[model samples]
Target: MSTPTSPGEGAPTDALGRALRLVSFAMLGGVVAIAAVAVFTVGDEAGSGVDAFGAILVSVVFVAAALFVPRRLVRPWPATAAPNEVKAAGQLRSAAFLSLVFAELPTLIGLVNSFARGVWLPVAIGALFSVAGLLLTAPTADRLREWLARMESAGARTGL
Candidate 1:
């Protein structure tokens, strides 16, 4: 709930910004590592039968959830909360965690499929989704400020 800072105003030096960036990078790193392992171990032939079907089904579910869930989970700032950096930080942290978890889900599913069935497609698709999500939603200072500003504007319009 802190007053939204202008772009390039050095918000990253704040504690909340540092924590958000650290967590965002950690999640991205995990996805990259998993994807790399899966890619490096590719073998002959894709998976078949029930194993293949299950992998496909699970992958679909994970990808769908990844695409849809994070936005819903990142609720707006609470009205009763003090308007301060701590509140802003808490909101940013929550949003970042939700985004990262869903984004990483597909990659995890892909890794499992790759390890169990030796198929590369799922892993590759997962890597693409993971990287895209991480890049698009990574909680930098500017992004956080933008999101908070939007939420604040919405709250104002709704009379919250």
Candidate 2:
């Protein structure tokens, strides 16, 4: 289905979505970057729970600010493409939100491991899945329109 939003019209939402996407992914990437910089920078190991918590916190803070900040600070930019393109922006935004939310669980688990004791192997595996989930659903905002159509069709068949 076609997205109804104009490209730049959803900038506020779009920006938040983009922020969520990048920041969450960065949590994972940052770990790699940090490890490369120094295998042992902290008292705890590089791949410990504290690192994961820090990464997730950074992503959440960035996204929350983008979502709640005044439009003045988060001004809407002009449409990058035709009006048709704008429609998909909302889907992208939604996808970003969902992807980030999905990512948090594994990160949170990893975060907890920092304070407590848990098996890193499972949490690490879960984190990879979370990252994949986020990436796979990045286009979710656009899919909302499609889902709506399916719902409507189902309702009609059921005589609702």
Candidate 3:
């Protein structure tokens, strides 16, 4: 009875943007708090242990936050795509989707690098991996927006 929608953009920007921002700050605070706790609790005496703790703790929180918010926000977030936009689950004939996958590359690299050094030597590897995983999913919503905008413009020019 209703139209199909884009995944993350369903929430209108002007309205949902504030809520989204609020949620974002809250989530960020949560991760930072996790890091702060890890740092303060794990001082120089046991620097590696605490560093490991902070990293893993923050990493897990990031992953959990990413997964949880989308589901929670799904209801209230209306699809904000313009009519010509490429909705989620639509055909992926182009390379637009690659942006999302690669967007978190920087963060992932840092995490992985930390992990590589830590793996055999046993450092904050858990946290590094956790952060890397979190980074992996970071770009979806933005990538969707970018892809849709590209699609719309291209379609407009081609009269698609």
- Predicted candidate 1 versus true structure: per-residue lDDT over 1-160, tens digit per residue: 3443655554432566678678878888888887776777787555656554565566566556654565565456545544455555566577767776776777787777777777766776776777777766666666666556655653532121
Across residues 19-94, which tens digit of lDDT does each residue of candidate 3 receive? 4335444443444444444434433333355445554555455455544444332221124543432333232222
Among the numbered candidates, top TM-score falls to 1
Q: List the residue pairs that clash in candidate 2.
A: 5-86, 5-87, 6-86, 7-86, 49-114, 91-141, 91-142
lDDT of 2 at 136: 49
Q: TM-scores of the models, in the given order?
A: 0.68, 0.37, 0.32
lDDT of 2: 0.42
Clashing pairs in 3: 9-80, 10-77, 10-78, 10-79, 11-77, 11-78, 55-127, 56-127
User: Candidate 1 — which pairs collide?
Assistant: 1-88
Order candidates by TM-score, high to low: 1, 2, 3
Which runs in model 3 stand beyond 4 Å of their true positions?
1-12, 46-148, 156-160
Give residue 28's lDDT in candidate 3 (0 to 100): 38
Positional deviation of 29 in candidate 3, in angstroms?
Answer: 0.6
